[model samples]
Target: MATYKLDCNGGSGNSYKLALYLNCAGLDWQPIGVDFAGGQTRDPDWRAGTNTMGEVPVLEVNGQRMSQSGAILIWLAETTGKFAPAGTVERFEALRWILFDNHKFTNNYAMHRFQVSLTAEPVHPAILSFLRSRAEASCAIVDKHLMDRPFVLGERPTIVDFSMAGYMYYPAEETGFDIETDFPALHAWRQRLAGLPGWKPPYELMPVGSSPPVRVVTQTA
Candidate 1:
């Protein structure tokens, strides 16, 4: 058995992706909660060891530390030999979507949600609109691909599903869009992920009610 440590904050899709992967793979790991509200990620000990960048979802394995959600996912998949495709092209495809989610989808949607829910002041209309459009467009691309298959890789779930599921776990109401309606295949895929053995939400990363409620929105096609 390998010992793994995860430093995480609940409600972050990035963190949830790691958690979901660990559970689905039946890997034993310890989770360390970081208080985002109190800026605990910036603490001296955390800065020196687990995460110098002061970001959540850092992973410590066999005395080595790693950060960044996508990087962690890829490392875990490769180390465990689970969910990762064996073929070179398929593996490259998985990595492509993982990067797409990080740079294209999450950057826009997560920022918009964070600003609207966590910030004290109103968000700028221009920025909000731009982010919302980006999110919608990203979803549309996913929808087109998902329309033909149950999973991004077809027939089997891979690390790409794990990566994408993290972002999709949030209700569309929070992002100001309906996911199921926008991407029915994605909605079904989420249900499939939930059915996996040992599946757990990002809530394990929090101390209890430390995060906001996930707003629910009906999917519209």
Candidate 2:
């Protein structure tokens, strides 16, 4: 079995994506806790030694340090031949969804979750509104797409599913959107993914930032 180490915290859906893929794919992996709330990512030595981008989910595998959840997911899929797109057409299509997910689907919603439920500092109502509106729009698109398909790329689950599922398992309070009622299709889709073997919740896999409502709240000033 190949061993993998990833910088991870429970609060990070980005990290969850990679962790989820590893577990579901039956890979031997370990979570290396990062003090995200303790300013570990901002530390210069940690940055230089691990990931200069100062991001979690820095997967260390085969003597390589990989960053960016999408890229890492793609690399994992290609290397493992598990959860990969079928052909070139599916490959490009999966890329499209992954790109859209990173840019719009998870982007604003993640920031919204942080500001409203995770951080201790006060957030402007206007910012919250903007983020929510953008998030809702992207979410609607995803929900509609999922309405017809079992997964992102038809019947089989792919890396695109893992990518899009980054923030899906978060609580309604944290994400501020009750997916069960708000997006029926997406909620059902989340359930389907959860039913897969070797699946576990974020906090179960990485407990670095498990507590809610700030979890100490030292960052994001």
Candidate 3:
């Protein structure tokens, strides 16, 4: 049996964060696809049993459940001693970037992608504009931060890279942002991280076609 079991939705960048890290680290893990569009995660039973927050990337290790990609990444880094911060300052920097990623980076980016590509209904133009602005802001900050660095922590890959890279690997159409064109520095950083040994794309690390199609309900008068 694998040492870890990850329950996640293929389209979820949060899930991809953990899944990608596990794959690149060459950990013994299994993927359990979640049905996000089918309301599987929203089910009371699931919420109470798996994750009280009703979120994806719920990792089960040694029969213990863990949630939140940031927390899990920290734990994994500490436990495995790979992709870990070198010392005190690096550790603090890593924590800062991870928090920034969760707050402003992946948070806005994933929300914008959901509105633009994942949702069946058309989102309001104003909402789309708001999301886009926030996402762009995060991108600009990270791009500038990585302008002269090889990785999030100056030299080597770390958990912060995994956190920030969660949504970057998805198709341009889905994300509606051409990082390679608009943000060259960020794009280069992504490529550098992708070159890590044992690295795999999101879909390859976890099943990507698990979410059920959105169904439309008709009302009879």
Report the poorest 10 consecutive residues by lDDT, candidate 2.
212-221
Clashes of 3: 0
Give me candidate 2's TM-score against the actual structure.
Answer: 0.93
- Compose the digit string of candidate 2's lDDT tens values, residues 1-221: 34898888898999999999999999999888888878888899999999999988799988989999999999999999989999899999999999999999988778777777776665777887787888889989999999999999999899999998888898775677888998999999999999999899888877764334443322222
Each model's TM-score, in the order given? Answer: 0.87, 0.93, 0.94
| CA RMSD, predictions in order | 3.3, 3.5, 4.8
Candidate 3 lDDT:
0.86
lDDT of 3 by residue, 1-221 (tens): 88989998778889999988988898998889888888888899999999999989899988799999999999999999878888899999999999999999999998888777767876787898899999999999999999999998888899999999899998776777889999999999999988998777877777743654422322100
Name the candidate, 1 or 2, with the larger lDDT value.
2
Q: Which ten residues in a row have the lowest lDDT in candidate 3?
A: 212-221
The C-alpha local distance difference test score for the whole of candidate 2 amounts to 0.86
> Where does model 3 exceed 4 Å of error?
212-221
| lDDT of candidates 1 onward, in order | 0.74, 0.86, 0.86
